[model samples]
Target chain A: MSHGLASRAGRISAQIGIVVAIFLFWEVAVQTGMANARVLPPPSLVLPRAVAMLGDPVVLYNLWITSAQVLLAFVLVAPIGIAIGLLLGESDYFGRAFKPFFFFLASVPKSVFLPVFILAFGIGFTQKVAFGMFQAIFVLVISAIAAAESVSSDFLKTARAYGASRRQLYLDIYLPAMLPVIVEGLRLGMIFNITGVLFAEMYVSRAGLGHLVSTWGMSFQMVNLFAGILLAAALSIAVNEALRWYENKVGAWRG
Target chain B: MSMRTAGGNDDRSGWILLLKNPLVLRLACLGMILAFWEIAPRMGWVSPVMLAPLSATVISGVTDFGVFARNLGVTFGSLALALLIALGGGGAVGLLLGSVRPLRTTLLPIMSSIYAVPLVVVYPVFTAWAGIGVESKVLFGGLYGFFPMLLATAAGVRTVDGGYMVAARSMGATRFQMIRHIMLPAALPSIMSGVRIGSAMTAIGVVVAEMMAATAGIGFLITQNRTMFNTAEVYFGVFLVVVLAGTIDWAVSVIERRAGSSYPRKVRTL
Candidate 1:
């Protein structure tokens, strides 16, 4: 047991070691003029720039815009996507019939439709939220349909046999049962939604993290650009960890 | 006989019983959805300026075939080249890593973490390195395709049944014989599924990269038309992408299904 733990610790350290090694190499390259600072900024430069930029109102607002779009996307799409899934998933006929629509939508890059979304909802926060939600809706609906279909008829029959109320039946039985798949779908939905919103902002928006990325590119501020990219990466990772925590929490709640 | 079995067990010849197939029936179900897209604008159920009539989009496509065809050809070229690089390089790396326990333990988690990041947003970095054109698109698409294929290949290799390996070893089976008779067939399904997902994502990544900034590509065409508010042309471009991406997805799905049928999955893969 001790040996196993040691090896596990060794493996983790190796992972960390590699990441540090890469950064160290980058810093050395920048210092030695082996790499162009104008094109790619090292961590030594980017971290300080990122810290300074965090105090700027525009940077903070852009960050908020990106985060809010992700939040709005999940808030708007989750229930609607699940509802649509339930509506269509209740019947096998409807499920098969609508499968093609889901397939086509899911396969296509939702970012390309950014213009359509901007036109429909305008270039404000609404457009970003709508675009993110649109991509997520397909993912959630597909998962929801699968979850609904997987609910055993025997359980429903037993509940009905016991004269369970409609709300109680769904709350006590269906919700708990399907939480895993639902959370999984939600995670997948959110990841793509985040990407979709970022892509939309980069393509056309006047403000947001993605826009900041473009702005930095135009001004040739490699330090700020690298920092922006890193910040976005950190945001994505944070969101991912949050969702995973929620999934585990749901599992515990059921237990 | 089941409707599927009656269709010949293989979908290719199975179409001889096409009328009896569930696949066809499901496709038939999509007709109304397609019709809604086509007729909604024409019938003024939606704004004509917003959504073009399907026929109008097609007419635009035909009329401006030169522009559409050129962009499409370039996009396809980039995608094809990207997939080829991904399959060859990623497949080898994933195979080696999966078969080696220490490597898998060290690398797989890092790959998984990187996978969740919005790699597409790093397009500026790629453009800076490779410049804004086919090279950048191909690289973006290739990286997108590479991760999935690698992860899948690793998962496939690791999940091979130990019992089979043990039996082969005991029987004095040579390494080549063991791989050919046992490893290849056993891991084929997971590898095929990886390829399936890789192809789909490659199409998406390439198109989106093109859309973001491009001198020539289908996505560029769509963007140009949209900027001018030429609704029909934009619609046509989107339609072409839908058809192209959908076709690639469908074709890969068929291959994955067939490749996976020979060996059932023992471990769940993402």
Candidate 2:
């Protein structure tokens, strides 16, 4: 047990070591004039700026709004995706009929629809939510369909032989079998939704992290822009890790 | 036996059986959608301008094909450059990491952290540095595509079955030979999937990079039209991107399927 713990510590130390080395190199390069500070600000400058921005209520509010948009979109699309996927998986006709359309929708560069969305819903949260939903739904549906199809035929047959009804077979055999795949789909959906929200904000928003990034970028406030970017990156990582943890917890049930 | 054969023929007539075949049903569904779209505008249920009919969109696409082609060429060029860099750099790093357990453990999280960062935010930095040109797009695409390929390659290498290495060693194979014959073939499927994903990432990178800064490419077209309120042209630009992305995705899928099928089935379960 101690040996295992030591190895874990050693692994973490190595990771930290790498990060330190990178920072040290950056600092040295900037200080020694080997690298231009204008192009790449040292961590010292960037980190302070990030901390200062954290105190701003507007930035926090924008972050909250963006997060809300992503979550709402996920909630809106996930159920429909699961339903459509199950329907398609259960019936080849349904799958065949809708699959191509889904593929086309998925293939479309969603950023292009910003104009239409703006036209229909105006430059409001509704439009952003719609874009996010559109971005996430296709991936979820596709993944769910694939997952549903992956359900073992033998398992379904056994359930049937035990006098299971259609509903019972679906509930007992299909749902459990497809849970992992559904979670995976959800992961992809979340990622796409996050990306969509950022893209939408960049394209048409009065305020958001993305807006802040662009605003600072145009002004050439390199330090503040880098700070905003770092914060956004941190938030993305946090959300992803949270989702990963949730997936693992849910996945444990399959055992 | 004759009665059983007759029963089988009757069973095959079920609607459920027909619906179970995706290819036929999917095509029919697409036809139905197109028919609906074509009819809806004519029936005045939807405005022609709001949702341009397929014919109009196609006509506009062809008429503007020269501009689209030039934009597509730039986008594809950047995508190709990105892929080359990603495959070359990612494969080399992944191989090194895979062979060195400590490095893999140390770098994997950092790599994922980089991947988790919304790349759009960083695009401005690249644009600011590289200016509004193809160089920025290539860099963006390379950055976006690299991590997936690296992770996939590393995972592929690590998962090379021990038995294969043992067999190769027993035959007096050198370390390089073992890697080439045993590890590479074992890792091919995963790496191919990575390449497929990387292709999409590269396309996305090009689009985002262009959006951030570019005078050409579909992204530039969309941005230009959007600002000008030329919704139709905006749609046209988007449609072109969609078509290009779809074509590339289809190509990748074909390659993956072919490569996957040709590889020994024994490697699959691994």
lDDT of 1 by residue, B142-183 (tens): 887888888898899898888888888999999888877777
- Stretches off by above 4 angstroms in model 1 are A1-11, A32-34, A152-172, A249-255, B1-46, B167-181, B254-270
TM-score of each: 0.85, 0.85
Residue by residue across A1-255, what tens digits does model 1's lDDT show?
Answer: 255888989999999998888889999998899988778787898988888888989899999989888898899899999888876788654665566677567767666677677556767888888889987999898888877877778888999999999998989788877787788789889998998888888888888899899777656667788888888887888888788788888767545
Q: Write the per-residue lDDT of candidate 2 for residues B1-270, one digit (tens) a residue.
A: 122222225545675565455554666667887888667767778765445556666677788888878888888888889888877788777777775777878887788767766778887788778877888888888887788888888888888878777777898999889877787888888888778777777787788777656888878877776677654566677777778777888898998888778767675432
DockQ of each: 0.43, 0.49
The weakest ten consecutive residues by lDDT in model 2 chain B span B1-10
Q: Which residue pairs of candidate 1 clash?
A: none
lDDT of 1: 0.82
Model 2 / residue A143 / CA error / Å: 3.0
Best by DockQ: 2
In model 2, where do residues sit more than 4 Å from their true spots? A1-6, A100-116, A150-176, A253-255, B1-28, B36-49, B166-175, B253-270
